[model samples]
Target: MSSDTSKFGEYGGQYVPEALMPAIEELDDAYRRYVLENEDGFVDEFRERLRDFGGRPTPLQRADRLSERYDTDLFLKREDLLHGGAHKLNNALGQVLLAKYMGKERIVAETGAGQHGTATAMAAAHLDVPCEIYMGERDINRQRPNVFRMRLNGAAVNPVTTGRGTLKEAISETMRDWATTVETTHYVIGSVVGPHPFPTMVREFQSVISEEARRQFDDQVGGLPDSVVACAGGGSNTMGAFSRFVSDESVDLYAVEAGGSSLAVDEEEGVAPNSASLSTGTEGVLHGARTKLLQDRDGQIVESHSVSSGLDYAGVGPELAYLVDEGRVTPVTVDDDAALEGFHRLSQTEGIIPALETAHAVAWLEQATSEQLGDSVVVCVSGRGDKDLESVIEETASREIPNAPDMDVFSGGMR
Candidate 1:
């Protein structure tokens, strides 16, 4: 609402091309007038969509089995149940509505893992706006199901082959496109990782997650949880799940990073090996935000690798960076193997299949002993796993821990 909300502890600000200044300033003004001021029923219409369309007040379910296994009480905030299959829809729908208020007819977004892309496309379709999504060529190949979903919603998905063909390059490309189409287009950033207004804007929309979870948790548990955990990749869901609890001194907050592999400090330069940006990064600027980043000695951003594409970003949200620096948030990591195990365990035990991105939080929660975390913990089950069947299949086949019985040759499985 006010410009004071921008620049989280000296982390977020307008750092972009001169051409983008007007657009950023305009959107900032609109955010204040429409969202902060609630001008002309804008907030009313947005809240209605969240309730009727995006499925607000998502459930907070108790994970009894997981709790018992880890000797602690575990609860899940099910944002996965939201429309478009993940927490991305919260921001996507909000931005689409704001774009309408701004008189922008077209939308462009950058996505990794395609959850944000699908959410953007879905919101655009519902609002009858033209939409285009930028994705890396590699992401298009691995995340084909989501790419198809975007096309089905009438969104044009552009593939970038530059610079490892991942989210970083896709962001670079999307920013360039937005610079040219600033008059008629609004750039819908997928997460809470962009410049000043964006990190603040997206977080506000997603804050609904924590707001709902807080009330629900209080109703169910009669007290604040011992800790709240969420995976951090660009940090929208984490910010959503943790923002409300920052002042609750008794509640510990955890942001689990993509533990791709060994926690070696510099296993891979430019990339946070195992995708642990906070654990293996120096402070630098990337993608128009000043925050914790992974770069080489020469200060070039490197490519990050993780089984979950969403976590493979070189930089993290400025708010999260500030939180980490201030010691208000603790950063941990879970590798790909642990994440997949959590995926399999939850699907088998709770009948819930979490997205690879979300599984990281689940994995960390399951691994933390009762003493490590308190008797009760809440995890942000950020998204569903329908988009990850292919990757999971490929990973499980190579894993040797739990043997699968051989199936009949003709039949796909044992009769």
Candidate 2:
């Protein structure tokens, strides 16, 4: 992985224009220097802060009840236990610290689920730097809890209403903000997407999960698991878990995408629910990088829909798209019902309420059982359900077809 000139694979090369190349190159240089010269102490300090402040090394627990029910071995990499209640904080801390080291002030970021927004805000508060987060008006309405958390942490949240008022639009707003304030502001992208160093940089910070999970799983199971599973929105948690094990060909890496309604059918007119970037997306430029996006024949990006706010994007990270194309990663889709069912199952069975984003992985576990994955699968529980409670309750309560059969009637019968 290190031998490759690009970050993860060929998909992660710097793809910005000549004008931004210097800035990208400078960031790459700084990051490379920091990794080579300061990684040891930097990582130690970061880990200390994670434990004492950010709350990390979250447990890797056996989902015994779910495993028993599904007749498959299931373990959760409990990132939900991390401070700020998601895996976002891991990279946020790394980036914010890097900003401080570089003598930059005023952190800026964009968020969809608000996990990243809250994480960035928390990091800025800890480092005593002013922070601003751009969120979609739709997301601000949906993820109210996180918006409140951001304010409490002393960060300003700006709502963007252009376009469809979703993640893609918020990203555009953020980029515009970054272009205007590039000198003194560091734009902390939430996930392993975007252009150049962002995909590489975010992955490096989040790679800690794979590093720790490998050691923990090795100690507990005597070797690596048969497969590593994670929910991929912007592909951070999946990248976090897969980065360390990418060289281990024996371990299968599975990424679950949000199949909103019918996994077998597209929710969009003439596009299948599974037709999002991973499946139907074509190579194109979006969010400052050439990536696989679900676009029309005329190259207009099509709107994407998913019950989970985090996964409702029209494009995926370039690296992930390359991984999908190269067959290094297998992408699976789980419908909204399955995801909600998985969310309820985890909450009732293991007392672990997962974020709607993380629930995608849980839903995949249900399918994995029928395929007989044996007792060796680890799912990245990327975020907690605290941010998703109200929506989950509302979703689970609204019955689909009156008198419809309750698939999980035994799992406490809806929220």
- State the C-alpha lDDT per candidate: 0.88, 0.80
TM-score of each: 0.95, 0.91
Residues 222-327, candidate 2, lDDT per residue (tens digit)? 7988889999877888889898988898888898888876544333553435425676577877776677777767677777777788887887877788888889
In order, how many clashes per candidate? 3, 4
What does candidate 1's lDDT look like per residue over 272-326, in tens digits? 5667777777787787888888777777887787889989888889999899989
Q: Could you tell me the lDDT of residue 255 within candidate 2? A: 85
Best by TM-score: 1
Stretches off by above 4 angstroms in model 2 are 1-4, 7-10, 15-19, 262-275, 369-372, 401-415
TM-score of 2: 0.91
Q: Which ten residues in a row are the worst by lDDT in model 2?
A: 1-10
Q: Which candidate's lDDT is highest?
A: 1
